[model samples]
Target: MPLSEFDIIARYFAQATPGREDVVLGIGDDAALIDPPAGQQLVVAIDTLVAGVHFPLETDPYDIGWKALAVNLSDLAAMGAQPAWLTLALTLEHNDDDWLAAFSRGLADLAGEYGIQLVGGDTTRGPLTVTVQVAGYLPPGQALTRKGATPGDEIWVSGTLGDAALGLRIAQGQLQADDSVKATLCRRLNRPEPRLALGIALRDVASSCIDISDGLLADLGHLCAAADCGASLHCADLPLSSAARELMSADSGLGDLPLTGGDDYELCFTAAASRHGAIQSLATQLDCPLSCIGLVEAENDIHCHDPDGQIRNISGHGYRHFNESN
Candidate 1:
């Protein structure tokens, strides 16, 4: 017999991760009762993943589960919050016990690593979709925002960019690579690491911050808009993985992926130039790559400066849901 909705929840979703004291009541409750940490602000974020919109249809169930929660966690990380609780609403076309087991394991593994508890959620029969909501905590008045950047601030991004876009190409059969390179790129697309530690460390350091979920240039455009300023990115200074560099070297057109490709999930932030040393120290301490790619400018436009001193104005934005072109 196929599993019923409640049975599925009990066998797969419930107790996926260890219990937490703050979770007064977890799965099986009508609604989760959470005790928020004292004297801290609450940060909540939600994201929905459809069968083929957020990820490819043929993608593994395990990856779907991980990515669903990871994307929501990325939002909390961008706000410089410490993740605590999560709830999932899962929709399925049909019940498959093996698929549920794999998906639950994937979700549980990441939640366990971060000490986050799955409190409560719902399951229903419908088209395949996953919606996850995560709640986090932050010290009073310490949350990072995209509005504090100044004209003279320097721009920094964590980790290399564009790998996920390349991974998508590989998955879609538009691009090909050797086995090792293929695995690396695909992993990046399927499993993005939220820069949680970096976000927390940056609360006092970054003048403003945002995550690079959309393309780097597009999200940076948002930061600029929030601060009512402009930016100049030095193309030569962009951080790229060896795989990306190798691929782009063969096809110069691929260069735009790092700038306009979404799904990097790294943090893009701005800080005063004087904080260079401090930022560098943080990079070393955290063992995460931090690249100074640009500078905030007084001009109200986004410009890219090539190594040869030529300037190109950029007017394009990142991925949009209703964009017929996307």
Candidate 2:
């Protein structure tokens, strides 16, 4: 027998992603209601998490819920939008009330902390999947885009790179790590925080911006393509977090993983050199450090510096749904 709509709601969708004022209507309704503040342009982005493809089958449901919304939030961050509302579409392999409860709890906690509203959603039985659409608002003419980067613009990135990728490696037992470190990296892999505040602060000043949902080299190629330019990135300047550095040092095989591995969600953006100080100030204000990793050169080609003096070229990536594999 099929599950009833209300049963699905109570079992899985109720309070899916917490509450906010903009959630004019929630679950159990024909449609969701949301209101963007006056004078703000709305920006929207959608992402999907597929079980056994996007995430492993043994993954925690709570972390899955957290990541589902977090990835969508990162899209808004790329556009420099303030999050407003979200709509979810969840498909379950089987209705498990315990799994549903945990998922809703995690989703709600993250949304509430971010002040984003869970306006509405639908649920059904199928191959496990979570699709989230997030809406955000920005003042007139203030959203960011990839096409703004230009030759001679400076490139910057927030936080460390590759930890999440490393986390996945650890989770899959491809890399051996102690329990404490393993837990930490896996958490980063599963529950990414979107860089929304830094994005908003950079809107007017940033030349172009994108979240690093893909690996750094690939995502940078995207910005370069949009701005009709190229860049030679400095390998030394890559802001590998302490955790990632330790993991890489422990395993020689992990050298290029940071450059090609996706799921970091940090913002890789560019701005004029003159705005460096302001960018620094904004970073301080947002409580997230920004690193000057490279300069935007002319559209010659996409190059990432090789620490061993062996240069490597990289291509474009944002998210490719059709690929079905990262």
State the local distance difference test value for candidate 2: 0.83
Error of 2 at 91 (Å): 0.5
TM-score of each: 0.98, 0.93
Writing each residue's lDDT as its tens digit, candidate 1 over 1-326 gives: 88899999889988788789998888886898888989999999999999888899999899888888888888888899999999999999999888998899889988988999999899999999999999999999999988989999999999999999999999999998888888988888998998999999999999999999889988999999999999999988999999888888988778778888988999999999999999999999999999999999988888889899899644456788888877
- For residues 1-326, what per-residue lDDT tens digits would candidate 2 score against the true structure? 75675787766556555576666777767897776688889899999899977888899989998999999999999999998788889988887778887888778878988877777778877999999998889999888999988788899999888889889888787888878778878988999999988888888889899998878878888888887889878877888877788888987777776677789999999999999899898878888979998899985677778778667644434345667555
Instruction: Report lDDT per candidate.
Output: 0.91, 0.83
Best TM-score among the predictions, by candidate number: 1
Q: How high is the lDDT of residue 10 in model 1? A: 88
